[model samples]
Target: MSAANKGKSREKPMASLCAGAIAGGFESFATYPLESLKTRLQFGALEGGKPLTPLQALRETLNQGGTRALYAGCTAVVIGNAVKAGVRFTTYDQFKSLLKDDEGKLTAPRSMLAGLGAGMMEAIIAVTPSETIKTKMIDDSKRAQPRFHGMSDAVRTIVREEGISGVYRGLGPVILRQGANSAVRFSSYSTLKQLAQGSVVPGSQLPGWMTFGIGATAGVITVYSTMPFDVVKTRMQSLKARQEYRNSLHCAYRIFTEEGVLRFWKGTVPRLGRLILSGGIIFTVYEKTYPLFDSIF
Candidate 1:
């Protein structure tokens, strides 16, 4: 490519990332309560039906402290997800440039690869510190004189005590989750959208509502396919299990052996619910909004 074209390409991805961050931040804020609930459900034992239904989880969270407890780590989520989502969309699109067909049309396989690449990139760039802090905040196992008081405190503590390494505890499962999630999400969204459009090349686009529907469908697929990995990542990152589980593989093995194979699917219900809504919000907002950034920058 010419230098001029290369320079132009750089700017476009930057704008897409900016627009994506805005959309992601909005979606994260809107859906964070469900996110918190999902995190709770992922914790504790799940066998014998015991306790902790979704409603019970909600009650427990509120009763644990106050209404504010429900949004314990919302700040970390919003910050991490803004950058993660932005990078996901930007890298997917950027990688698509390399994977597209001669006619510049994206195939399902190519789109999946691009999305996987985007997911890996987001994990490295945005998932580690934010997720570590979020997990630590919500994890009440250390409720007795918590190690970190809040987000800023958590960051300082991790950095001071464990250095940079502490902030990236569950990176293995995080990468697995993000990579699988983006592959399924982008591939399914692209396929459904193209099937709806009845075209190989980009043609007339669907309405905003239909685009949302497609995105939700994709999110549902992503939730189930990657829930086990999500559970591992959450456990590995959360304060409670960080010491219990040695690593991602150890976490998975313990869950399968002790918690039962089905336990790996813990919290999938809330996650599906959350992701379906978030998927619609993300794709709809990003699609509707990014074009404006494209026009301007």
Candidate 2:
């Protein structure tokens, strides 16, 4: 094939990553208030330190942090998710291509496996540091004595005080949570979209509104499936110079034993809301932009 034809053939691989990056950045910024709330509830006192109700959390976030504070680590999130979405979309597509059968048939299980790989890749490359900064900012704001003035200050302080490891404190749980999350989210969304389109292949596109609704449904599924891991991840990451659990497994065991099995579901309300909206926005943007990028590339 000629250069033009070759570029055309590779359109998806070439542009999918870039398209995803753009969409991911915008989605994260657009939906950050929910994320801040999610993170706050995830670490706040379940029984102490003033009730952490959803409305109360929202009020506090706005009052204490201001509108700007609502988007505490927006830069980290946008940049991180740009990389995360880019890597995940590109990697997942590659994996799915490889997993397709001789007749170009891709099964749901294979799609899930690809999503697993893509999630893990993005977790390692992006989620760890992004989460570190984000969690820190929110956790700090809750205190009368805030830690850092801004993202740059937070970065410098964290690095100076705790070294780089501070940024990766809860990596284990992050990996597990994200890996499972992406797998379930992508597989379910794809399956739902396929069913709606009445096909096993990727051609028939759903209406934009339908896609958003389905994405919200998928997000609900993801939130419930991963809430336990998310709670543990937050606890592990949010320890404030006071050592909490020893590690991820310890964190899980402690939360289960000390707080009861039900305790692991902390932050469910905000998390559910955030993810529901997030899933709809992110996937809707991705699906709509994907073809545009493919054609342009």
Candidate 3:
């Protein structure tokens, strides 16, 4: 390859990785309170009780342990999401490259397929264990006698009590949720960006506002499409998984039969709030940062 082409090749993967890492970590940290709320709502849903509104849940969490309660599992998510997003974008780029046409263009279907693979890859490598730990920590914090003092304590306790399987409690639903999530978000974002730019050209530049808007739209679409899987994933990863849920399907069944279909979307408001912000933040950060990384690296 020409020296310029070789340089571009090297830049692509590294830029994608670094940009995605920063984007994911920043987004997760900024929106962690919403995530904490979502988990608590999902956990509450497992009890098949009257659903708490987002404001009520927020108030209850704050009252229970003050502002710190809202960030009970932030550390795990920020770290895990960083790694997961790094893997996600790098893998998505690789898949996109492979799936592109002879003209080096990617269609929507191919983009979705690439995202699907990327999502599944990230889920197995990072999201599953991270989410399990985060959920357990949040659950423990709700107890009369909380066990884990922090991230390390949570990890040690979970490992001692349940082994590796404990940290991977929701692998199946996580993979499904993430795969569908990426597929919808990435494909829609790509399609929306193209529409906004009025072109299908690769590396087409868009204004920051446009990128954020498109990303947020894509996130909303993703949240609605894959919500049930997300709820099921959270329940399966909870500390009481063995006692409350036989498996992902059983969890879904119970949620549907006992709590009704809407119960599967118990955490929608807070989760939607998070995703809206996360979509805007992650895509905006990644797009802006990638070029800088590309030039520097």
What is the C-alpha local distance difference test score of each model? 0.80, 0.77, 0.86
RMSD list, candidates in order: 4.0, 3.8, 3.2
Error of 1 at 186 (Å): 0.2
Which pairs, if any, clash in model 3? none
| Candidate number of the best lDDT | 3
Q: Write the per-residue lDDT of candidate 2 for residues 154-187, one digit (tens) a residue.
A: 8898889889999887898889988999899988
Tens-place lDDT digits, model 1, residues 1-297 = 001122114336876788789989999999888888888788766223474778888887777776678888889899999999888888887887777676656789988998899999999899877887787788742265556677888788778977798889889888988999999999999888768776433444567888889889999999989999888888887765655877788888988988788878878778888999999989888887776777777
- For residue 69, model 3's alpha carbon misses the true position, in angstroms, by 0.6
Winner of 1 and 3 under TM-score? 3
Best by TM-score: 3
Measured by TM-score, how close is model 2 to the native structure?
0.90
The sequence of per-residue lDDT tens digits that candidate 3 reaches over residues 1-297 is 001121113337887899899999999999999999999998886556677888998898888998888899889999999999899988987787777677655689998998999999999999998999999999888877888999998999899999989999989999999999999999998788767867434445777787889889998999999999999999998888899888999899988997789877889988999999999999999888877877877
Clashes of each: 0, 0, 0
Judged by TM-score relative to the true structure, which candidate is superior, 1 or 2?
A: 1
lDDT of 2 at 127: 90
